[model samples]
Target: MAYVDSADRGRIRLRRSSLICPGDDTKLLGKMETVAADVCIVDWEDGVVPARKEEARRLTAEALQKAWRCPERVIRTNGMDSDLFETDVFAAVAAGVDSIMLPKVENAEQIIEANLLIDRAEQAAGREAGTVEVWALAETVQSVQNADAIAEVPRVTCLIFGGGDLGADLRLKRIQLGSNRTLGIHRYEYFYAYSRMITAARAAGIDIQVTGFTSYTDLDASREDAEISAQFGATGALAISPRQLPIYNEVFGPGADDLVWADKVLAAVDAAAAEQRAVVVVDGSMVDGPFIRNARFLRSLQDLIDAHDGSVG
Candidate 1:
């Protein structure tokens, strides 16, 4: 039996929505506190212009200090090789943010280096050790290739896919419809990269998030993408706008049928246990280890939903 530790259990109790707000947008930052996202990410990588980097960092730091009740705060720093990388780390730590997101990571060494910076910054800020967590953005082919190594970093709590940058890196054009137009002709072999990252995160026992659709106006598109990622074992999806929050929350969360099945399975298990039996039958099918594991997971999800007041349903 796979036992969920206190941290993983706590994570399961929280909402799954991770909302991405531009670091420079203080108005959105203020409004986000009222939103239902479990994690709030202030993006400094692709969201800010080169000239506005400093301003965005300042605003993000200020928001972190002023915001009274952000559930989980994350700062998406510039890429590892960027000129602003060090500054981003220092600012995020000094601002007392919860986590720092390292974008465009290519391997485990980069994660180690980033963790070192975070450790030093936390010490300087008089914060306790491991006060901050690290989030790795697997955005390149090299990064995906080394996904397991990166995910194994002790400081890493979650991993996310940066789809737009990844798509550009693979030189594969986006297909609007469900069909994979690029896969039919183009030999760029990065389509399976997303699944590889998920597998790595699962192996490391960390939460994995998938990039949300950029088209926020279309709820259907966002919901479809959320469903696909959820099916692929992603715990959640990033929301670019507040409008997409409800959709992501709904799609990633446990559904009505899930609750029903969980209840039935637990009932059967309880009955079997009373009879001194190790197995039971539910819905005309023999239920055993895997079924019990899934039921426990569903119970955990329900417990999480009950604990958080921001659940969409």
Candidate 2:
């Protein structure tokens, strides 16, 4: 059965930190199981060498089956065109993974095809058809254009932006012609594209995750980036190292201040409703319907955090 329905659509929350473990690396796999990430993504795509793809797939399958107390287990498969796609999908199903992350997804048809494959594989294995959810990586121009359709795929639980591949595909250079040490031009365009993808995911009622930053050692920059993405409506972010996990968790999860403010706003809104008023004042600030909605979202985050037994902190 599907993990979420219309009633649980917006309620299925996730924290910012998702640790990406290369499926072929058994050492990393062992380490990731004990890490405090909201999700653990075993990567069978860019992280593995072509020669080791099969081995990676097998190891990832084994790791998932042996994982202890993992909150979420995801497998990032190669693109649909890759020879490893079928193996990755089958392995994930056999191992009982929480979700399958399909990279370089270009449109709705591709997502539907992947889902169909999953359904067939599940039936062949005598498991439920919709047991594993699909997550798409909107990495190409076509994917961005078809973001809404991809998110609306029946078995897709989330859509993630693959920034590195996307920038390369769009021919965005990291150099500012005259300066070797400086950042890239067209930075604004990147942000614009990110926002567009997030908008599409939200509109389609699917969760969204930002690509993992390549700099695994830089926790501060990673945290800041995750926070910015969250502010732009991204539900979570991908992480490459265990060190980055805590930062992502803290930034994505609710804080004491957020809970306190949400409580006050909700209380004020409730009193206003009881008094037959359309507006409410909370701590001398005027609030209305929109503010109430924001409060509810904050409360939802708190509820999710609590449900996870405060692992976020």
**For model 2, how does the per-residue alpha-carbon lDDT over 1-313 read when each residue is reduced to its tens digit?**
4533554455465646687878899999888778878888888888999999889877777777674444778889888997778877887788888888888899899888888789877877777757688788888888888887887777777888877667777887652211121452223546877888889888877788886555667566666667777788888888766787777777877778988989999988778789998878988889777878888988987787677766534
Candidate 1, residues 1-313: lDDT per residue as tens digits?
A: 1222436523552437788878888898787667778788888988888988999988877777765433678899988898889888888899988888888889999888877888788888888877688888887888888999998887787888877677777776563222233343222343497679989988887888877766677677678767877888888888877888888778888888998999999999999999999879989999989889889898888777766655443
* Pairs that collide, model 1: 13-304
Which pairs clash in model 2?
A: none
Model 1 lDDT at residue 5: 40
All candidates' lDDT scores? Answer: 0.78, 0.77
Candidate 1 RMSD to the real structure: 4.2
Q: How far does residue 23 in candidate 2 sit from its true spot (Å)?
A: 1.2
Clashes of each: 1, 0
